[model samples]
Target: MSSAYNHARPPAGAASLPAPDDPVAARLQESARRMAGIAVFSGVVNVLMLSGSLYMLQVYDRVIPSRNVATLIGLSLMVLCAYLLQGYFDALRSRMLCRVATLFDAGLQEHIHTALATLPLRGAKPMLMQQPLRDLDQIRAFMSGMGPTAFLDMPWIPIFLIALFLFHPLIGFTALAGTVAIIAMTLLSERLSRGAAKTAMDLSAQRQVLADTTQRNAEVIRALGMLDRFTARWSRANERYLRENIRASDVSANLGSGAKVLRYVLQSGMLGLGAWLVVADKASGGVMIASSIMMGRALAPVEVALGTWKQLVAARQGIKRLREICKATAPPAAPPVELPRPSRELSVQNLSVVAPGMERPIVSNVSFALSAGMGLALLGASASGKTSLSKALVGIWQAASGVVRLDGGALDQWRNADLGRYIGYLPQDVALFDGTVAENICRFDETATSDAILKAARVAGVHDMILRLPDGYATRIGAGGMSLSAGQRQRVGLARAVFGDPFLVVLDEPNANLDTEGEQALTRAIQALRAAGSIVIVISHRPSALAALDMALVLYEGKAIAFGRRDEVFARVSNASRQIAERQAAAAPAVARRAAAFEGAAS
Candidate 1:
């Protein structure tokens, strides 16, 4: 166990990645630098894009009029070279964008996973816990697709328009009007579809939550004959999502169609205006055709931009959501202190905890201290705050007020991952990840040794039971240990709680699913843990489990009623109950006689 604990920390001189709080900004900065490089390449590509117009001009103006074969051949070769360069630059920019996306994922994936794991500690519902990863993928896809290229080419629109003006002012003015019209249509599309898009996204998230819940509880739904009800509920949610999605798509499609029509009109109008200019002797036939081509080129990015507007909008929303989540889940600013191994001293100083959205504290002003080699039993009825108190002790739930400390340091003083090395907890819900029994016993620590795994199983007395399986410790368990019986799951969780020489262990309802033999094993596990100089805290409703504990704390309505040696606290509680019973028994005869007299008089 000690060997496993010792190997958990990284070496002192190892290269450290950026802290979780810094990764979002660091990744953004890195991506921006890459985008800057791509932007330079885009400028070159746009410049080379004018090769076709120039080629047309040379062919009609110089080669055709002068009938010079040498000049025509030379111009064709130049145009070919220009197209080749443009193709190369375009491919390079696309590759750069893909690389930027990869870097961004590398920087943030681990941090997002860490936040998701710790979100329950903040009492968050985590309804969309996996959404951020999907959002990251969305951003990556947009960066590599035509959407970003459209934006990059947008600035070159004015350059093309300027070239058209030099050819003939009428052509330039006509093209400018078309550009303004397209811009107006784009804005209108955003205005009409923004609300629908947001609504659709929210509905989709709700549908995902419902689907996840139904899948996880398929057994319960089938057993209770609730399949039809769940299916109907999901169908309604999905229909709403589809309706809003179609509405938003319709608006976008209309705008895209309008932009395409306006683009064609502007191109034809430029040609007609150029012809009129030629007839009026303001320009030649070569200038007429070249000006139309330039006008069409100027408006191309706008057409593409309007066509991919939905992707741009979605990417914008994804960015905003990612920023908000990262901010909300950022770790504390202060670096954690590196403390020595604790001596198993547990202290709770006036601790209070209230459930989320509730005014009443579930555990209020509770204080206790236990030394090494001692075991304390918390005896309470259902909803008596035992589980909440246990959660606070192990640092899963934050205290509303006061502090819980190991040795002499408050829980928050140590880094959570570091503190976790010396503490273990078994929650009421015996959830196990999809893995082998050995992996679960070692808390899924990759560095854990086989000896440590075997020792933990032995301590929990689940070794023989594990061996009975076909693959022994190597047997695979399904998600949430669905493959195991309730008792087996609980026992495996117990082994996990005592895996690595932890100084403080808290088990809530440890024997809830255990049979007679299993309960006896649990008693021995507690005794062994105590004899090893560890502090053991057990929350149990059964009196038999409490027999092995040396001390007891009795609670009622979130208040501690008694705290002392087990026999003393139990005696006080029993005496108080006996007195109340005796008083009630003595008053029963008088009340009965008075009721009889009243009945006799009425008769």
Candidate 2:
């Protein structure tokens, strides 16, 4: 619930390990090569940028005095071609950048999605779960926007500077001074807006999380008259996000305005200097206008960069987060060793489970072994670690210290995808996806046949109920698909658990929302599972839920207080503590009465 989920960060000052063959990094390197190709187009575009100043130089210096119409027409045609080429190359570079963005995303988006799907099991915070996707989006946007072009154009600034110097030293130095000023402003904008960008990102994440939570619990909030309180919390978060955004925008806008003004002043100064040179017979009048045009071209990239400073900051932050995620995440095992299907037993040795952000273990120092064809009921009160133990057994929550061994191999030894085929679990709170009744039963397994789905439903005694629905097995049912009663949902969940005759099945409070009929179906499902030589574990406090279970484990405050044959455990533990008050009272009064009678006889 909080943002304290352990992300398994690498230790600081740890010895560096060998570099991984990271596909994301490799894709980026390929993108770098694409960016390099665009640089060649950038070079061609910059070269053709001289067309404007050159046209002005020719019209002033050559055509003005000569009064030759044919010469003017020829020069016009040449400059037109130059301008056309320049635009084409500029557009080409932008298109190439977009292609680069597409390729980069196409290669890594699937991997990023997989990482997000398993984030909860890896102990990721609810708010931060979407951050990696946000990072990918930001990077994609930057690559496809004007931001990349500005950065590309920056490297060609010296070309314009060289042209300006060829006009006059004073003009060159003035443009040079203006360039330094714009560069200084760029640096200042980055420094000032860096903190604002990061703060804004944090506030935005908080605001989004609040909005999502409110929507998900909208009915509950309205029922409980809590809308006003939730709105207040959302308002505070939204205000913080807006203020930080405004702060960042102001910095970039101001710097952009300042850079624009400086470019204009520098252009005028360069023109004035060129005019002086012309009058002094050191340069021609044509140089005056040409230098002014060149000055604008020279500083254009810097000005554009200043305008996009906020976007640049966002993209940089995105890259930083992406790197952190990649570094913190462990790569999946390659060609994971396949183990034979488990058929012997399910064993948990000295198991303890500590959830993320908690120092105390929810399930502690518990051990149990169940052979094939056995059924076990885990009995405990509220918060007595029944659910936690069930989750650990099903590999939903990792064991803090212990081994969940299927056959002789630990759960970790089997690949997750491969291990899932032999394990079935129904959580306390049933969550059905937005899919058909058959799809939900088959766990959305596209390869599952109709027979398997029907078998599971029949075993859970939900086959008749499902057939009564409007579309039978094809009926859509879920939060947005179709609403079902709580009892109906629980029975469907039971059917899902027994699909494919899984080797290990764990159900937590399976009968909590069921009717008497559903309860009977649950017991039958457990019996069928055990008959198939599957190890079945049920977590419940209701005795009816344990009707089909022979073995029992009693938990108290996270410890195994008693465990063995169901009748024997209850007998021993009950006789030891069940009637403590009545037994102690009778024994104490009898001893006192005997003492008093003896005293009376002595007297």
Candidate 3:
């Protein structure tokens, strides 16, 4: 079991966030470029099809000679063919645009995941503003339709505008005037939408807060019978989200309606002016037909252009939020200097840690070292910096001053993944996922085999207990080990810590909640690790548990007052313990008499 604990590694190919240099941006740009190319093609095809339809209409007026059967049939057939081709072109362009949109969504998600993983603990709260999963569906829906539609408008607008000018100079002037008016209206819409997007983003973050609260306090809410309070919070969150969504929708509708009105005004004006000229014999039937078709074609792109305004506003906000996170400095990368592959040697020099937002340091200037095949015990009262020091050794918490080196390399120099490979920790409170015993043991090590898992379970002294379960090692544990006894959870946590055969092991109060038999089992597991040339450091208040350690450090307040072999440290602190015990004993009788009087009156 010790062998398995000390040697397992997570399976290769486990999913992780993409690196900083991942090709997401390049991929997004490429997809946009491809969609743009397709748009250009479709625009050219639409222009040709429209021109062909106009030519057929002219033939019916001038060359068909009052519905001559054969000529009329031929012209109708040509118009039908043009209509079919236009439909095909529109479908193809739509598909290509949708593909670009999907690529953008994928890239954005990839970048978000990577950024979240790199942020230090201090930056966790602010970073949540960018990637809340609650906004994911709305963002994706907006992207898929708006992304391609926005890009398609770019090509068609220019082509239609130039074609309108070529048809008649006056009509061209009227279209340009309408374009100016639409631009002004769109700018107003943009301002409105931007404000709405910001509000929506804020509301989305608030919704996440409610989700986290509900999840973290699920047990407390049920235990304390606070269902009404939880329900009230949830209702408030729902109302806020709905209100923001309504505002965004209202803004979008206003923008669309305003732009449509401008397009209709321009279309009507052009058609009216063209009809006056045709009646005054200043325009031909063909010229009027061409002018009307040009206006219809031109109006389509303008309407699409105006609708893209809201999309631009929302995407702008998303991109801005993403940039803020990506540009924030990440944790310093591990240095290149290689430490000797870790061995069962742990050392600390003048180690001191001032926890973030704390006044006095939790751990003071302290120094200690342990070699292979040895064990050290930390003995202290409650809140004596035991867990703080243990955390520093495993690189979970960085020290404010001094260094912790495994083998010979500084802890900070090791990669995050490689650091876990060298040291293991079993915290005082064990946290487990909802999985089988084997699954929990292999949580950090997905590739561990059955033999490796059993080996860890046996060494941690949980092998026999697991085998009695219906599924043995596969027995499913409830969340946070709710299904297991406290001692069982501790054993499983220890088994996981040892699973990779880590060179250094740190346990915080391993015997805290364990019964007498359970403590004995844990003691044996520590002994086995020490005998196998592994260094084991344990924090405990139990004297019997401390007796197995080769060395001991006695702490008072936050300082290590004495350190030596187990017997030597105990000898140094023996008088102090006796003095405190005698003082407590002298007060015990009076306290007991008061308690007895109170009990008698209650009876």
Candidate 4:
């Protein structure tokens, strides 16, 4: 990470504050002692780096003048051993850093995935859906690259500077001045490019988001002949991002060239000063050459740091972003007390659901309950919150001000993993994964029995349909996998939802893409689930799929207009609709008469 950036580290003495409860933050901070050990390794390696210059000095001063071949050979062997040890320790330190990055990634992958998967259900949008994953990638790259090495070597730079001082006061001061110049250049580059870099990253993320949106709706766009519009949009975003990226690159390039040119000039200047010293008999010729080499060594890490500042800054930003996500979306410190698999009842009490990032409830003050073997159908207009209520019922979306309960226990009382086993949900859109039909139906449960898969298919009445496929239940079906019709996907999703005969089965528009036969099968599945004592909650506009449900809830806007047994609720809805139509019919004559009178008066 960038040595210059905050990287989510608190201010001085913040380390003494009780450690953050975020497990991800804890995992990252817990590695401090190990990092110190790596720093220690850097110290040894940096000290050993002086071996070559010292060897050159000895060769020029002692071996050359005295013709001592044995002394030269001894010094060469000692320097070689130091070089070998230096390589060993440096490699060891880098390897250690790589492992830390790997461990950090492994610990957070699942949490990142969970957060990504739930964002839509929460009606939320982060800067980018895949950013955390990308952040992890940057961490891995930074760990394996020269970024960490630069930071580790930074602390030992004083060693080289002190050596330069020991050579002579003037030589030491010259090297220090060169180091300051490099630092000044780095600060200037960062100051100039920082805003551009940030803008470029933001614009790039927006481009990715647009690309994902367009890809998902490519068929719609092509069919509606809106491809040109989307292309224009993409071009605009790409152009903006490209411009900022070029700006940032130019700043970095200019500063990098300056640093390199300065380094060579500094080395040459050091040689000139050393020669003057030798001529004055203040230092030897050996001192001149060796001091030049030492000057280069002293500035190696600073140059490396300057060259890689961009990467370090990106990594540092990634760390801060990931830490924020981990903190905001962290799961509870302890898993909830695991409740037994829910059965017998599904309950909603004064339920209200407001989607994340929104002020008002999408569905409000609706209450209902169902006992084992009962079925309820939610009826609503397209935008009347049926889907929101369905999501809340299945625990996909949390209620704004009420509780969804299973078997008298609030849904939050049980661990999500434990609770999920007893809950089955088929959403309006059925997205199958890349797997065999049977595997998808069984939710990819590795230990799922074949008999269980067949049972769910048979219950969903898709058994015969699956057998008609080229490979029957073994057929590989998904996007870019084996092709399945919309009805086939819906049926398969139904089978998946009911697999293992979950206690509460929630289906939102299960028949939305179904044909007559598919709808018939869906009706049979709902009946079967009810007969098997499962509490079935269905939200649908189609009447055929509600053939077996005994209760109904009708919604208009966000409020329930009718709720009762199937017949009573339907009759109430029908009567209310009729009354509204009749009122409008009677008001039509008055509205027309009033309009005509106003027009006549104006004329």
lDDT of every model, 2 decimals? 0.84, 0.85, 0.72, 0.84
After superposition, which runs of candidate 3 have C-alpha atoms over 4 Å from their true positions?
Answer: 1-86, 97-114, 117-120, 126-142, 284-293, 299-302, 305-311, 327-340, 354-366, 379-384, 444-446, 476-486, 541-547, 554-562, 570-603
Taking all chains together, each candidate's TM-score versus the true structure is 0.92, 0.90, 0.81, 0.92
Q: Which ten residues in a row have the lowest lDDT in candidate 4?
A: 1-10
Question: Candidate 4 versus the native: TM-score?
Answer: 0.92
Which residue pairs show backbone clashes in model 2? none
The candidate with the higher lDDT, 2 or 4, is 2
lDDT score at residue 456, model 1, on the 0-100 scale: 91
Model 1 C-alpha lDDT versus the unseen true structure: 0.84
Most lDDT-accurate candidate: 2
Across residues 1-603, which tens digit of lDDT does each residue of candidate 1 receive?
233223322356532433645566767787788788888998998899888888888888899999999999999999999999999999998877777777676667666776677666666664567677767877778877888788889888888888887887777787788888888988887788778777877788788889989998999999999999999999999999999999889988988998888888888888888889889999888888888788778888888888888877877787778777777777664443488878958888999988754668999999999999889999887888988888888887788999998888998888767788899788889889999999999988999999999989989989999999879999998889988999999999999999997899888999999999889989999998998998998998886677678989987888888898988988998999999999999999999999999999999
Model 3: how far is 130 from its true place, Å? 7.8
Per-residue CA lDDT of model 2 for 1-603, tens digit only, reads: 011112112245532433355646766787888899999998899889989999999999999999999999999999999999998888888877877887777656555776677676677877787888888888888888898888888999999999989887878888898999989989999998899889998888888889989999999999999999999999999999999999888877888898899988998888888888988999998899999999999999888888878878998898777766765664456334689889999989999999765779999999989999999889877999998888888888889998899997888887777788899899877888899999999999999999999999998899999999889999888674337778888889889989988999999889998888889888998998899899999988788889899898999999999889988887877787758967888799898999999999999
Residue-by-residue lDDT tens digits, candidate 3, 247-290: 98798888789788767777777778777777987765665666
Per-model tally of clashing residue pairs = 0, 0, 11, 0
Evaluation by lDDT, superior candidate among 1 and 2: 2
